[model samples]
Target: MLSKEELLQYSRHIILPEIDIEGQEAIKDSHVLIIGLGGLGSPAALYLVAAGVGELTVVDDDLVESSNLQRQIIHRIETIGSPKTESAKASLESLSPTIKVNLLTQKASPEVLNKLDSERFTLVLDCTDNFTSRFLINEWSVSNQIPLVSATAVAFSAQLAVFNQKLQHACYQCLYSNMNLPEGNCADQGILSPVVGTMGTLQATEALKIILGLNKADTSFLLTYDSLDTAFQRFNIMKDPSCSVCS
Candidate 1:
């Protein structure tokens, strides 16, 4: 049950027919895990908290740096040198005191992933900047039957996809089987601030939709966005028969 304050706090969400009181309640009861506190995780965490996800666990081994503030909106000048997970925790708690934000100020090592599997999370958001982390997350999500929302951004382009093992949707490896693909490293190349923010927000939207069981009718697709052109494109994502992760 939501408190009177919470009802008023989420008035806009409750007013929506697609996300009425029941949906709002479901959101409030959901637990989410967010990996990486960089550009993508920043907006993803903020929106999920604002949407009333009851518990959120954020994992990031990096620290706040001057370079990151350009896209990582969840941190501030005052938080420089502080662990990203701690900084994100402070920002999220300030947004919704009722929401629980857990911080793991360590790397997403295999051991860490194993520990996370012991708990039940409604879904996971993979906002890491590397393909290795993305691959590891995909493997774990597939093995544990958890839904995963993954996003990547570089320069002016961004891509978003969701992999739900429970639904038998295409896994990450199934979509991008080649590990030799170019890394869209913001540090190496460059990234438009809004490009990552836009993708991360959509990641949060997809997560909520999945939790509300509102994604059953939507066909599997990968969404690509170009900030320069302000264009969005969708490509069908099908599971690979020989996919090592989900096959």
Candidate 2:
């Protein structure tokens, strides 16, 4: 049951016909693990907290640098020296004290992956920029039977997908069978601020849908967007029977 404060805070969601009180309650009871606190993770974390996800675990080892201020809205100039996880935790707590925030001050590693208790999280959000971390997350999600919402953005382009072994949806590896990392990093490629924000927000939306069971109709679809042309595209993704990670 939500407290009077929660009910008041989430009145907008409760009033929505698509997401009634029950959906809002599911969001309030969901636990999300967000990997990375950079471009894509920033907006996703903010929206997830604002949408009343009960628990959030933010994993990032980097500290706030002056260069990241333009795209990482969660970190301010004053927080330049502070840890990214600390800044995100403060932001989320300030936005909604009712929500619980966990800060993992280290980069997520295969060792760290081993330490994760799969049962604790309802879903994992892969906001990491690199392919190594992305692949690791995909493999971990498949092995643990956890659902993962992955998003990536660079140079006005973005992609979003949901992978769940339990649901038998297409895993991330199914989309890219081979590991070929993006050539330039966001730091080098120069990402448009709104591009990352849009992708991250969409990722949060997908995560919420997964938690609320609204994704039952369509489980394996890839959504891509190009901010330059304002074009959005969706493609049906199939699970690779020979996938090394999930198969």
Candidate 3:
């Protein structure tokens, strides 16, 4: 049952045939854990909060720097020196006071992953730009049987994927069997502002679809986008029987 305020707040969603009041309620009861507060995480967090996700946990240890202001729109110029987790929480809370926000102002470690109450969260979003954190989140989510939405963007390209243990879906390791690719981040390689925003928005949309039970097919695939050519490509992925993390 939606309160008067909730009903009004999610009126747009309530009217959608796919996401009626029941779907809106599911979103309001769901929890998402975001592993980074950078470009991809920024828009994903903002949209999730706006869509009425009940609880959000942001994990990041970095501080807002001048260079991050272009795409990390969640943090403002005034928050340049503040911790990323704190800045993201403050901005999200201001956007939707009804949503509960949690801040983990520390780097995510195996210890932190082991301590998390996976049952309390419906999904995990891997917005981390590094391969190490990406693999860590994938391993933990696979072991805990939690669905994960992963996105990464650099320069003009981005990738999005959804991994779920319940469906025997492919994990990150399944796609990138080895992490031998050259390491490059936004700090080293400049990124177009809208590139990250587009990827993050898609990540949020996928998360919402999973939460609302609006998606009936397995979304266990990879979506690639190139802003320069405005081309979107999707590659089908399957769980690798020899996957080191999920197998």
Highest lDDT scorer: 3
Off by over 4 Å in 1: 178-180, 217-219
Better of 2 and 3 by lDDT: 3
The number of clashing residue pairs in each candidate reads: 0, 0, 0
> Tens digits of per-residue lDDT for model 1 on 62-151?
989999999999999999999999899889999998888888988887889998754579999999999899999989888898888999
What TM-score would every model get versus the actual structure? 0.96, 0.96, 0.97
Stretches of candidate 2 off by over 4 Å are: 178-181
Q: Say which candidate scores most in TM-score.
A: 3
Whole-structure CA lDDT of model 1: 0.89
Error of 2 at 181 (Å): 4.7
lDDT per residue for candidate 2 within 1-247, as digits (tens), equals 7888888889999998878888888898899999999988999999999999999988999999999988998888988999999988888888988789888899899999889888889989999988889989998988888899999988888888877677877899889886455577687888999898998889998898888877774557788999989999988888788988777
Error in Å for residue 109 of model 1: 1.7
Candidate 3: 10-residue stretch with minimal lDDT? 212-221
Q: 2 or 3, which is superior by TM-score?
A: 3
